[model samples]
Target: MSNLTRTQEKELKEAFDIFDRDHSGSISARELKAVFKNLEISASDQDIKNAMKQMDINNDGEISFSEFSRVMEAQFYRKYTHEEIRAAFDHFDKDKSGYISADELRMTLSKMGKTFRKDEVDKMIKSIDKDGDGRISINEFMDLLN
Candidate 1:
């Protein structure tokens, strides 16, 4: 959380608030499950239990914003090798171009069994496409994944 920019922290806070549906300050397992359902993320009972167990650092059967943000920061510091990251970017950059176009992103996701509409694909690209390039540069892609 300390390393996150203000905007990033704000976004995380918003996500946490989404899970904290009861205005309860903390997110109970039931609240998290409802949020997951609302997002159409098909998390299983075991998945929810495991997630709750992992994030409830205080063993309180709930996740505080601190706990949730800590887990998010841990994920931000993921352990992928540099080569692995490059390979992933390459996989998405289908034409071997230096940047990833919206079509390439959509096709790559589709090939990997992910189905996103055109607007969805565009939105994903827009989020990572810094410099108003309308495409994802390798640096931007690396910044996002690594």
Candidate 2:
């Protein structure tokens, strides 16, 4: 495997620090909850449970820093590319009006045959709609992507 970039490495280290509250080389559910809370992203109890299930590869109810970093790196790599990161605002700017609307986003993903429950979509939209405008602009979309 390739080494992480300096920025990614630093981010992983900081995340580890936050998630590793006890400095015991592992993260418990409480630490995970703190991380999510600190980011101001509201995670449902089920979401936290599911995350614990997925991140705790050994079924130990806790995640080692290395495991946590690996899971995060895998997910981050799947969603981002050098070129996409460089031109994301332009690439996902489907409206061509220099913005991304919720409708545009839903339509684009729908065209790809993806599926999401109405509640799921609503939750995601709510998170990204920082202005409460019922629409997502390019800047907002970029923030969500990051």
Candidate 3:
């Protein structure tokens, strides 16, 4: 029932193999922590624990190949429904306009305590505004999200 393509499934299997250092067909918490560290991915001990708990669906202390495949497939290939994307866009469009202005983006980010340089914001807007419009429409936002 996964949306992942054959290529994606193969890649996920390869990655899982790499993480399963012991070839035990499962990855332990210590192995997961080492993999994160080796990849320079910043994750706290608690974060790793939580991730294991979520991925280890069988309540096992380790993540089996099937579990890893399922989790990776969901994480990488799952797409949000149009209504969910629209609802999120509506939340940001404070003026009830169909587009999100750079000002609105700045305000939202500011509210979130995330400050970015003016150039950075402009770059972000330019990147997301696929139609070269000055603002991001719901369609554009959804495209960016996907």
Candidate 4:
């Protein structure tokens, strides 16, 4: 009953395989960023820096594929339930319009204690605004969640 299909799980494993460049079982900061870039996902420079700091459990500035996989799997598992996903979308739909608008995104992020400049939020919205819509549909929101 998990939301993750077998193909999706396999793809995740494949991604982990490709990102483990050195075969040392560890992905360096550069490696993780490379994967993100390849996926066409842009994080703010500070976001990447913060992620590296937190995800590199040993403070070594490097994350093992096992470590990365563990985090990803935990996140994936947590949202395996349909209700969990629906609840998350509900949280993102700030206006209660059943969709996520830029203001909604900004407000939700701000409520989470993230301080993003208006322009920065705009830039982020531009990047994730799939389908050229000004707002994110539930499907788009789910994609971003992943």
Candidate 5:
């Protein structure tokens, strides 16, 4: 925690906030489970209970932000495999339109406040790729993710 830069801390806070659904300053198993569901993780209840047991850190049945941050930090050094990065990209892809170029990536992320269907995303990506004349490489996307 002491070695984390301010930006890293902010990123961790943002991630924790996503799981703290009730604004309770802590994350519960239900909240964690809901987020996992959204992320398309097929974790079982027992798996979640084990995760809670590992993350809560205080045996309190909930993960405080501090606990969450510590666990995230502990896991941060691992490099994402291609499959892992692709899975993360797929999670945000929403419409299954596949990857787009950098310009479309920025545009699509900017419009995240609105929902886009498969056809819409496909249309947008096709138009952008037609103009840009190239697609985004997985390595490039992985760099963006990093």
Candidate 6:
């Protein structure tokens, strides 16, 4: 099972609640269709049914919190293509240094309007910096994403 951080879990729960209309504590097919419609994604009845079947771990024809969290968590950590990883790495390496320093990460997050403390940024860098080089190389970033 995927272990989600508290923040992630909260976000996922919020999303699930948005989709679970009627205060049913579960996502019905009609509610799922409404969600797709709100997202402007075209989904047929069969498509919705198939998705419900895949996410309804207990085969109950609906998605409970546990099932919704599991499916959403898997989607959250889905692998990225090499090109996507390279593009992200390029965006983070503002100095063109081929490696992302903790300061760069902080600045990037700031630009995106997401703030983190120095220790949090350091922890993030440490998690992705496989070489313990105090920075994130392209390879290290790719490995972390994949």
lDDT of each: 0.82, 0.70, 0.82, 0.70, 0.71, 0.85
Q: Each prediction's TM-score against the native?
A: 0.55, 0.50, 0.51, 0.46, 0.70, 0.54
> Can you write out model 1's per-residue Cα lDDT over 14-39, one digit (the tens) per residue?
77876777879999999888766754
TM-score of 1: 0.55
Clashing pairs in 1: none
- For model 1, state the Cα shift of residue 16 in Å: 0.8
Error of 5 at 103 (Å): 12
Instruction: Give per-residue CA lDDT, model 4, range 26-133, as digits (tens).
Output: 777776676666544577778788878777777777876556665666666554456766777887785789777878778766543355788888887777888887
lDDT of 5: 0.71
Clash count, one per candidate: 0, 0, 0, 0, 0, 0
Q: Write the per-residue lDDT of candidate 3 for residues 62-117, one digit (tens) a residue.
A: 99988998888875756888998887788678898899988888876554335678
Write one digit per residue (lDDT tens) for candidate 2, span 22-111: 788888888788766654558988898999988898888899877787788875556665466546555445657766666666655453
- Please provide, for model 6 over 1-146, each residue's C-alpha lDDT reduced to its tens digit, 9 standing for 90 to 100: 65888888997887787787677999999999976775455899999999999999998888999999877898668888999899888878989999999999998766543568999999999988888989999999888778
Name the weakest run of 10 consecutive residues (lDDT summed) in model 5: 106-115
| Residue 87 Cα positional deviation in candidate 4, in Å, after optimal superposition | 0.7
RMSD of each: 6.9, 12.6, 9.8, 11.1, 6.3, 7.8
Model 5 CA deviation exceeding 4 Å by range? 100-137
**List of clashing residue pairs for candidate 2:** none
